[model samples]
Target: MLKLDAYPQGFEEDDRLRSAFTRNLTLHFSDRPAPPSVDGAIRSAGVPKTLIRYWHDPHDVPDDVRACLASWDRLHNEGFEFRTFNDASATAYIAERYGAQQLKAFARCRHPAMRSDYLRLCFVLAEGGFYVDADDVLLGDGWRTIFLNGTLKLQPLCYDIFSSGMVPAAEIWRHDLPTEGRIFYVNNDPIAAPAGHPVLRRALGRATEKLLGNDPRPEIQATTGPGNLTAALVAHARDLAFAGAPFDFELLHDWDAIAETRWDLTYRGDARNWRNMDALGI
Candidate 1:
């Protein structure tokens, strides 16, 4: 079992706690040979080469969210095509490809997390671009440079244990321990892929299956979130090897590179919320 001391001064100030957290979080591809250099990867992937974001309104954007938007705008100014889809447009796109029924079901999704999760997959699969969460700020021009220059990068959600302090270490270990003894969980927040990439296709299939089941209270992680994405990736890698296609994955950066804005002020009461609730042991 994992034993965690009470972080009296909070995790940010405690180096030991931070180190332990990082150590427990394993990257699956760390052992494999690194993928091709970023430039080579991007060249191979080809393009519409765009950036996509979904928002209800650009006019009423929040300050923190604006920061993220500005970063993307900077990328666009520098030459990348950036696209924003409001709710209506997003729904219409989903309807065209999946059906009106699927669109209605997606509309009824109460959780912002769930909605964005599904939309990002649909958008990326259809358009073949990068999807960055509205709240995730790009560190610098390097974010665009690295992505355009390199291959597809998967920033799978690190398991939530570091902040939640709820699941026991052994229990988490038993369920999440990678078969290779180490693997990273794919995150939905910043996913990029080529149009018709097999991995994204598989994830869309799995997500659609989950949605059709009408599983009341679909766990965010397992249904439209990282857990499902990770499973799809694992399947993709295995299938690719069998089919003789080379698959190599790499980390985007060290944990500290990207800055995440706190969400406590924005989503305080939502029980299903995941991001930025560190003080609540989430």
Candidate 2:
């Protein structure tokens, strides 16, 4: 069944964002109580459907996140689900995708590095398959169009500067970066993949090789953060001169496009909302 997993932790800030999202979703879509396969999961978990699932590692689940979940449960009638993977190693897709050597490169590093691990975990779930970031909100309630298509999808790593957290340092920062580098991630907001695509596999393989390499100047600082990942993708595309791939989907970057386009919906709220929120100085 199609399963949506939240990062093991770090939803405290996201909860409010999601609350806004949930409100908007209900207001906009309201097609069904839940997306396909989601209702059953909620019922099986025996939680209120309104609650947002906290799928991060136990330690990763922040207090604010817990509060958000609780609030979501109480406020919304719909139920939600929470899950975890006891075995990190088991989340691997490519046999050698994320080895010990590669993990240490960023494991126990900074939040950015940690965020990279989360992203890697998502890719792990995807196995180069397909997954979406917490944001990447939908518009006009056409989620089923992509979800039902039975294809794997992922947002590109590039496009926006803020969401580029998953970017490898070597690719972007050039010099060695501190934990602050994590902030520069490539947002995987609305990633997707076709049933059978080799790009995902290749991307994982490349990430694995880059991470496992022991050079002090590891290619891209052993990061596959969203921005770096997206940069790497474009770099690869330019190198191979390949085109017309599933990864070539749309990205909601520009303010104009984000505001004007009908498909401009995102987890961060609509462009006008973002602008207004920023203006409110909150």
Per-residue lDDT over 15-49 for candidate 2, one digit per residue giving the tens place of the 0 to 100 score? 23222222222222222233343221222211111
**Per-model tally of clashing residue pairs:** 9, 48
TM per model?
0.69, 0.40
RMSD of each: 10.1, 15.8
TM-score of candidate 2 to 2 decimals: 0.40
Cα lDDT tens digits for candidate 1, 180-273: 3222355666776667766677777777777767666556666777777766665555454455665643445432254354454343354435
Query: Which stretches in model 2 have alpha-carbon errors above 4 Å?
Result: 1-56, 67-142, 148-152, 156-186, 194-196, 215-222, 235-282
